[model samples]
Every structure is written in structure tokens, then in C-alpha cells.
Target: MGGYGDVQMIDENGLRMDGRKPGDVRPITIETGVVPVADGSCRMVWGTNEAIVAVYGPMEAHPRKIQRQDRAVIDVAYNMAPFSTTDRIRPGFNRRSREISKVTKDALESVVLLELYPRSKIRVSIEIISAEAGTRCVGLTAASVALADAGIPMTDMVVSVASGKVNDVVVCDLNKEEDNYGEADLPMGVLPNTGELVFLQMDGDLSPEEFKQAWDYNVDAAMQVHKLMVEALKGGANS
Candidate 1:
């Protein structure tokens, strides 16, 4: 978080600086089967954060050692485009992107029935075309959609979202400014139907009550985001 502490992010009406309630997430749009060449793909836009995910797979695993005898391995690469931020980010694997990619792969492996396809691999590539904040969550959420589009069997889809505290108030789906200047951040990946968590992470400071509020906000946001995912898959061909 930034050191700009005096920036007030909440008003007396309990509304956030962006005019949303404490639990309200920004607008979201999702589309599936977007990349023609990939076996499956999804594009999602949350606020100004845009991510595209491509899935290729159950193909023969390569480089012998990485292959598993009982299940397919998931390879994920999370990248941010040069033009995706206010300051251009150089292309390559940075620490932040690498960590996010690892978490994304882990989250996906939890839901996908990988053991069904031994000696195979699944590649999930996430490209951030526009990043506001929570790009990793958006990428993970879209990856689930792409897996579904590919007709891969899974226990359930994961819906990811972030919530944070700014000006002593809890807010859902932090934008770029809030993310940089907020007091705390909690991101989680949840199964919409079961309310089970597959991914979790937090940073900065928050009291117990504040933490609960953030978790609740993420839970509520995930359900709404799931609706968009369903719509996007239905409109895949048209999109």
C-alpha cells in the first residue's frame, strides 16, 4: 500500500470514493472461447482490468521430468502487457507475475479432475491487456471459464475477487488507486455453488472484524461474478 494516508476513501454515507457500497464490486463482463487457436479461452473485464486466458491440453506431456504418472500437470504463465498500466511494464517474468502464476495454477489444479488424464498437460496462459487491480483474480476466474469451455470436467468453477480496507472502511474490488493506497487486501477464490475456497491470500493490516468483512465481501462478489461467467459462456460463439 502507498503512503498517501490522508486520502479519504469513504464518505459519511458509507459510500466509497468510487460511489459504491462496502460490498459492491465494480462492473464485470466475461466472454468464453475467445481465442480461436486455443482449445478453450475466456476474456473477462472487471472495472478496467481485462484478462484473456487460453487453455490447451490433455496433450502429451513434454520434458519427461515434469510429467506425472497419475495426473496431468498444469502449466500457467501470467503476463501483463506493456500497455496495460499507466507506466509500461517490461515483458518477462517478474516476481509478482511469477507468484501469481503459481497461485493460479494451484487454484486450477484443485478444481480440475487432473487424475483422469495421466501423461498429459494443460497449459493456462493469462494475458492482462488492461490492469486496474485484481488482475490475478480476474485471470484465475477466467481460467475456470476457459476450462469449462474446453469441456474439461471439474468439481466446480472458481470465482475470484478481492476486498480491502481504505480509510477504515471495508470495500470490495479495489481499483488501482485503492489497491496502491489501501490499508489491507484480501483476495480469495471460491466455488460459487459450494461456497468452498480454493485460493486465499492477504496483505497489509486489518483487525479481526475488518478481515471478516473483507471475506464476506469476496463471497458475495463471487456469486455475482459467476453469473457473468455463465452469460459469457452462453454467448461465446456470438462474442
Candidate 2:
């Protein structure tokens, strides 16, 4: 929750500030093989946010202390470039980046079949080239595509989306303006094929009914996004 002011984010037409009906997600485009040198890579643009993810290894888990004897570990580094936001983001690891990275790693771990590659490690690098809002969800979703592009084994691909309350109405995806003034945000990661959840996080409050609306919005949005992910992968390894 950023601001609780009486800023109207929904209009008389019952549409969001961005002219979307409450259940519409931001526009998205995903492309794979963006990083030629990496084992796999994907570039995703969601609304005004853009993220590039590169996956490397199942090679070797460096430093014996961090090595696992039976399964591979997923290492994620989520970073925002200096000019990622309107205000310059100071480069380097910060607390917020660390938390997002850890949560992303956790979500990926749930779907990736780590046991297939014993005692190895996979490194996922998430770079936010531009930001408006919901970068974390974008990063996680794009990372899954990068893993698939790299030919990794996974039980299912993850599709992440967020829904929130603004002006007493629940919207499918909050744009920059809505998020800055919204009171609640619920982000989720879904395994589209199985209808299973790999990740869920909430900030602020929602009544049970509001919560269900938001939840359904995310699930529906995930299924839609998953279709695009599959399309991108099918489109080939270029771009």
C-alpha cells in the first residue's frame, strides 16, 4: 500500500485508471533466447515494466559448502538497473532485491525438477531494465520461460500476476498510478496446467469476498499469460 488518499483510480464507467475493466491485465510480450551465451534466456515486457532473465548451469555448485549431494539448487539474483525507475536506483544488492530474489528462487524451486540433476546448481539472473510496477511478478514469470528455453525440466511453468484493491474496487493488475494509491495488493504464482499455487504474497487487507475476487482475477490472468509463454517458446529460439 503506497497511499490511502481519496485519489480516484476507478471511473464512473467502472474501468481502471488505465481504461481497463477491473479484470484486465497489462499488455505483455515475451521473447526467448535473448542472451545468446546463456544456457537459456527470455525478455518480457509487461505494461511499462521490462525484465530480462538469463539462466546458466546445472553445471556445478561452486564452493563445496553450498553444494547439495542429491539435487540441484536454484540461485536467483533480482536486480534493478540504475535507470530502472523514474528516480535513479542505486546499483548493488539491497534488502528489497534480496527478498524478491529469494522468493523467486523459492517459486522456481517448486516447479523445477531439481532431483533430475544431482549435485548441481542453476543460476537465474533477473534484470529489470525498466520499471513501472509489479516487477517482481514479471521477473518470476519471465524466469520460467528462460528456464524452459534452456531446456530445463520442470513439472510446470509458473505464471505470476497481481490483483489489488483501489478506490474500493478490485482490479486485475495495477498499473503505476493505481499501485501508488491502492490499498491492497495480492500477487500470486500459479501452475496453469495443474491449477496449483507455487507462490502467494499479500500486502494490505481485503475482505473475504474481495480476496476471492482478487484471487480469481490472478488465476484467470495467469492462464492468459501462460498461453503467451507457450506461444513465445513455440515461436522459436530467436529474439
Candidate 3:
């Protein structure tokens, strides 16, 4: 909880620091084909966090050993730009970025029909240009959009969201302040059409009921975000 002593994150009217209700998510916008050179690309902004994702390949798998005989492999690299946050991050792959990349690859691999392209690789690169909080979730969501834009066969798109407890109240999405000071965080990647989860992570403390509330919030938020994803893909096709 980062020693959030006596911090009042919610008002008497039950509104949060940014004037959002407990179940309200921050504003979100998504656009496709942001990287023209990539086979597929998307840019997504959730609150102040912005992530750009590019997809390349179903090309021959490198190193040969990484290739799968029956399906394609998904290689994901998630990175934060030096200027993305207040403190400049060193340029290189770190533990945090590696973990995020692995989880993101796992999430997308579940939905992508990799068997269609055996002995191949699909590369997903995620760049966080700006960060407020929940960059992992945003990156995963944008990667899903980018894959779709690339015309990859997939069973469903993955929608990621995080819900957390702040000041003993469960909120749908955590901004920078809430994430820094919140008591608990639960992030999940959901397949909206099937209501299945491809990713899940949590930290901090939460009672059983609070955990349930947070889970429900993430599920609902994923459905809402999935709508926007579909809309953005459709718009890209028309344009």
C-alpha cells in the first residue's frame, strides 16, 4: 500500500480523485495502423497511459530451436520509453519488462490460431510512450488490436483491465495515484466473447469479498473495452 497514511482518495460523495465513481473507468481511445511499416499496429490511450503496439511476421522462426512444429510462436517485447515516466528508465530489457512481455505473450497465444502457421513466429512489440499506471494492461490490449489489424486468425480478442482497492473501496481502474497508494490491485485479461481469462495478476491485501468485487469490476470493464476495440478495427477497415 506504500504507506498511504491518512490519504483521502475518495470524497464524501463517493467520487474519486479524478471525479470518477467507484465502477467508472478512465477515458479510453484506440486507433489502428499507427505503424505503417508493421504488418499490424495500434495505439491505445487509457487515461494518461498510451501504448503503441506493432505486429510483424508469421515469418520463419529464428534460431530454429524456438520454432514449433505444430503451431507458430508468439514473441512479445514490452518496453517503456525513456521519457514515458517521470524518472527516465535505462535503455535495455529489465526484469519488469521481461515479465510483462512473457505474460503478454501468454495472453495472446491463448487466442491466436497459431496452428495455421507452423514453424513460424509472430512478433509483437509494445512501446509505452506515456504512462500513468497499468501500462501492462494497456500494452496487452493494444497488442490484441494490432494482431487483428494484421489479419491474424484468432479465436477472440483479449481485453485487459485492472481494478484495485483504494481507501477500502473497490474501484474499476487505478490511475497513477490510486496505483501508488491503493491497498490492492487485480489485473486480468479477458476474452469478452467467451468470458474466459487469459491473464491474471494481483498484489496487496484484499478480503474475499473485496477480491470478488475487484474481479467483477475487471470483467465488466473488459467487456466495455472490447467494444471499443471492435469499433476501432471496423473503422480501420473502412478507412
- Writing each residue's lDDT as its tens digit, candidate 2 over 21-57 gives 9999888989998899999999999999999999999
Q: Give TM per candidate.
A: 0.96, 0.97, 0.97
TM-score of 2: 0.97
Against the reference, the lDDT scores of all candidates come to 0.90, 0.93, 0.94
Give model 3's TM-score versus the native structure: 0.97
Consecutive 10-residue window with the lowest summed lDDT within model 1? 230-239
RMSD of each: 1.6, 1.4, 1.5
Each candidate's clash count: 0, 0, 0
lDDT of 3: 0.94
Model 2 / residue 222 / CA error / Å: 0.3
Q: Residue 162 CA error for candidate 1 (Å)?
A: 0.4
List runs of model 2 lying over 4 Å from the truth.
Answer: 236-239
Q: Is candidate 1 or 3 superior in TM-score? A: 3
